[model samples]
Target: MASSLNGKVALITGAASGIGRATAVKLSKLGCALALTDVVEAGLSETAELCYTEKVIVAQLDVSNAEQCDLVVKETVEYFKRLDHVFNCAGINPTAYPILELPEGYFDKLVAVNLKGTYNVTRSTLSHLKEHADCSFVNVSSILGQRPSKEMAAYCATKYAIIGFSKSMALELGPKGIRVNIVAPGFIDTPTNASVKAGPEAVERSAQSVSLGRLGQAEEVANAVAFLMGDEAKYINGSVVEINGGLAY
Candidate 1:
């Protein structure tokens, strides 16, 4: 039996690990061909090997660069023939500290990879997606996008920007048959969160806030991304789906 996403092609950034890696694997099993990009070439290729279904192709992509964004999209189109889905999952969270205590450069770097990077990837894929008709862009925002925390100001800014960008794209591209959406995950336990887990009180506080009383898995977020990208979401767009186990509330 053919899956709903059969024959589709997808490009996922930050594909080396965490939600990105999980999304790539899920989409592949659902019958989508994959193009994987990340600054971590070794990890990206390793992820590709582990995918086990249509093996994802690894490409060194630094989404902070518009040229690399353009190249990645162009290469995916050349390889897969048509672009059907894109998941902008690449992001960074620097040291957790008060806004004033953080360096201006830290905010700059965070915005470059998180906000501007999504802009770069989504904008580059726009033309091809329009040509393909009925496609989707799923951006990985954070629960911090909707709420503020004392120690994570800059990361929050970019994630919040993703919701704004997704809404605007839905308005701009809806008529063009391109669906744009956002997935804002909260307290996800990825490698980056390992540091938080090491801090006993910090991890405890983080987990206590979630309704589920624990951290989220990367696969959980990937499931939402896959749903938004698949045909089941054909009627949905311009929506911000929160997968934080009610942590934001």
Candidate 2:
């Protein structure tokens, strides 16, 4: 609550639920005005309500669409006057299949939403970030980016690309006072993870595989993100912080 993010304006994509929803509330507590976006309008509003920030606004858009990305950024800035931070968290999991079994269409959509979606958000916001002396961005990646797993080749590839893109862009933007970083989370409990955890056999299997005895909470990741985007992490650019409870090992 004492962090310097107070009064800063932020735009977060995929803000309807999960980590995005958690982050919206976290940032609001830090006194940042927010603009939340998601393909789901109703969920976006739900997140806005939790934020409880009078300055909060919501928009519905598919981040993978460049034009929608452009419009969302433009409109968010127009509403907030200036953009100080952004969290590119809009993403989708790849089809759980072997490489040869995956379809080209599925791969394309996954990349568009996961890898290219991150690119689209930052590409659309770069100009605004450059204009602000203290612009900061944290792109959501996954511990999968650090490694791989069977039946998760496509998802791992996309997450790995996000880390690469964040580092490369960080170097380019650092001189301009814009910071870029990646937050790589491990398996976290969510609607998706809940289904995976439902069956007793699968839950037992995952518990054995994960380093942590239990799945992670979205707030845990949101806290780490807060630090990276805050003034405390001004020198932490071009780095990928893993929030996976040592799961990658």
lDDT of 1 by residue, 1-249 (tens): 677788788899989988999888888888888999998887887788778575456799999999989988898888878888889988885468786798988888899999999999988988888543668889988778988777888888888888998899999989888899999888888877744647868777888988888888889998999889877788998999988887746
lDDT of 2 by residue, 49-149 (tens): 89847899899989889999999899988888889999998888545788789888888988999989888888898888744477799998887798887
TM-score quality measure for candidate 2: 0.94
Off by over 4 Å in 2: 130-132, 194-200
Q: What is the TM-score of each candidate against the true structure?
A: 0.94, 0.94
Off by over 4 Å in 1: 194-201
What is the Å distance of residue 78 in model 1 from its true position?
1.1
Q: How high is the lDDT of residue 235 in model 1?
A: 90
Question: Model 1 Cα RMSD, Å?
Answer: 1.7
lDDT of 2 at 210: 68
